[model samples]
Target chain A: MSPAEIQQSQNNQLKFLDKPLQADATTDIIYMMCPMHLLTIEEQVREIKAGQVLSILTDYDGALDDIPAWCRKTGNEFLGIYEDTDHYKFYIRKKAPDNKQNV
Target chain B: MKTIYMDHVATNPLHPEVLDAMMPYFREIFGNPQSIYEPGIRAKEAVENARASTAALINAKPKEIIFTSSGAEANNFALKGIAYASRNKGTHIIVSKIEHHSVLNPARFLEKSGFAVTYVPVDKYGTVDPDDVKKAITKETILISVIHASPEIGTIQPVDEIGRIAAEKGIVFHVDAVASAGNIPVDVRSLNVDLLTFAAHQFYGPKGAGALYVKEGTRIVPLIYGGIQEGGRRAGTENVPAIVGMGKAAEIAKRDMQKRIEHVTPLRDRIIDSALKIDKVTLTGHPERRLPGHASFVVEYIEGEAMLLLLAGKGIYSASGSACSSKALKASPVLISIGIPAHLAQGSVVFTLGEGTTGEDIDYFNETFPQVIGRLREISPYAKGWEGAEDPTCTVKK
Candidate 1:
């Protein structure tokens, strides 16, 4: 895809990520173009749901380490990170005793 | 403690000579410049002498210089003052898209005041086309203001050519030289500009110090109203110490203009040449025409704040990205204007070298930066699956 087209698709995926999400859904995703350095961990924590399997897409930044550490602290499982042309798609299974969905 | 400062475009540390010149104004030379007393006379003479020195640096006469609180303030005075005074002549003004916030904000304010403004666009190298400028002028267009140099991208505008166009059209022209004044030679007469703006702190003078040069015949309404000061053009108690320091800074700049350019240009080139060896990093400004001490670039798969923070941790100081105000981290207008994808624009970093910058400093940065990038990229969502991604380069002027 063209770079602009790639960005558009990335943005479309990000829009999908920000939807009114549910923890019961199999997997929901978000593309966060905002830099983690500009954000506090508290801000990052607030973006998560307790029992959701989420894929948060962000650019190259501290969020890679930060999100995993947040997952570790809250007992969530980081499903590992995936990359496309210009963005990173991070997958995580939110912390819940009964949460098991991963992709 | 050794700290490498590469953010000189934002502000210059006060030169020791400037400080030495200013010290007496705070102590033995303390006097209200308006008073008739000996101390006051001396103070007034100092202020006038400083005005002469500042005027000399820009090839303006002493009568043309009006001291102000800062470059931003000088910009406001030039734009708004001209707008209000020339409203009867015309309500139209033109400025470029890549001007500093000071110029952009005042233009915006004018828009709300029944004045019409056309924002001229720049090319991929952050340059305004003189032909585009000539095309934008209307019969009602009374003024045109363009920046001499863009701090975010280190792009120097064609000021002399733009000045020629303005002179032919009989429109008042203003150049914001805050970014170019000390690091390069800016001769007002040669540029043929009617008004110009500059800040002291951009050239190793104190903060809250700036100057506006108004040509003899051009009329502008005063931005401030009060007792007689600055020939009834700008009103306030003269900032004696800061103004004196600016004068000293101007004199030093004029004296060392060639020498300093020779010293800083090579260092700037070395940094740019070394940094570009990294993958997917593109230089943002004009390669040949940029300021002597200025360099800028946008790196793929990274954001500016992260890069800046990492660089800072290594004892290097610089700026990342451009925001209109401190609150916004949105993609920079300058970068976007240059046709970089909005997402890629966030990766912008600006490095402005100055007097104390050294080769060893650039070496340390060159060595440390890639490691930090590697560390950050390893965890980056963008880089995670970025193997074999399409070329991020857009149709930018190289």
Candidate 2:
């Protein structure tokens, strides 16, 4: 394909999230776009202990260093990361278990 | 995912015309410009012609232009050469706080060598006052090096006024015009600069090629010493191909500068306008007296790195103030010097437009940025409860 055709195809691929998932009081997820988003680890942990999962979309450039470190420190289960041209999609599951751990 | 390059200040892709002009030198005309043969003489002529082209773009004589490997090397040559040559007159040098690392790092190197350096502060708009510059000057002050326009903030300094002051004092004045050259009109004579440095890659020329304009009769020593090249001011074999490209790029810039300025200015303003519509977004640097192709803003409560990532993901390539100064960990000294709070400085993004930028690119950024910022803010702890506070200006509704 020509450069213009390649660009057109790339643009056509970047659709927004069709429907954002809902966050109940007990089940929450934090979605963010950068490694600096991991700076709010304490707040994210607070929500996670209350049975929340945090998902972050980050740029691939610097995020490679920050997000895994955040998950390691916070004990949050890093779900996965997906990267498109310039942006990223990240998902993390909360560490907190059910009633036994809560009690 | 169509990439839109908006980081012209960092570097520019080589222009096709410039690349074409440079091709023969690399392959067919591969003789060293310094040799004595006919092919070498032809290569030498190409280098001289390139020198003249670079000189014409900045209103300097061809004889006054010295080609260098990079802007940093040119700056080092200007600072250390003048300091060493004129050390009998003085050891004190004056520079603005908002200078690029190329200028500032060299000043620091001079300071370590027992040269007393005075850093003049800038106002909230990132402009240094001429009066302050004059006041900073003393009998021992030998050189006043300032940046023509900051690469990070895009604020154009009052170099003409500062140059006038330096001239009256008979002190050597140098301006790092790497960020301003080709993007804006720069006449070394009008600015009364004794020395000026600019890089080729910043203006769609090849990298590893730049020029330093040394005003006629300015006394300076060579930064490099080896074979006689660059009029014996800079020594070493010339990168003939890159120099040819730089020369061609300069010719094009000289012809099309006004039109290029007209084309990029509105795109810059549009980006700024779109950014301002989002709540808590503060435009950094001088509003009117700034680089026409530069737009920078600090988005409160959002991390700049994250925003850059999101923007990059969207195929919008730009820079964050935080990442640019990643080694320092401190926010950009330019942003901090201009009185932008550290937190806000961490959230600053710089978008620099160039010749190839289009209205479609601007429209895409305008449409997508707000949504990304809104989405990111929703997950930020600092951004929580920010929406309904008395600080209505700080929050953007989805």
| lDDT, candidates in the order shown | 0.80, 0.80
Residue B33 C-alpha lDDT in model 2? 92
DockQ of 2: 0.01
lDDT of 2 by residue, B177-280 (tens): 99999889999999999999999998899999988998876767668766557655677799999999999999999888899999999999999988998999
Residues B1-398, model 1: lDDT tens digits = 46799998888889999999999999999999989999999999999999999999999999899999988899999999999867878999999988888998899999999999999999989999998999999999999999999998888999899999999999999999999987789999999999999989988999988999999867677788665678657888999999999999999999988988998999999889988988888999899889999989998887788988888888989898455311376667788788887677767888889988988998887887778778778777788544654443323211
Model 1, residue pairs in steric clash: A17-A29, A17-A30, A83-B385, A88-B381, A88-B382
lDDT of 1 by residue, A1-33 (tens): 677544433332211233323333321112222
Positional deviation of B169 in candidate 2, in angstroms? 0.9
Question: Where does candidate 2 chain B have its weakest 10-residue lDDT segment?
Answer: B389-398
Candidate 2: CAPRI quality band? incorrect
Runs of candidate 1 with Cα error greater than 4 angstroms are A1-103, B325-327, B384-398
The stretch of ten residues in a row with the least summed lDDT in candidate 1 chain B is: B389-398
TM-score for each model:
0.76, 0.76
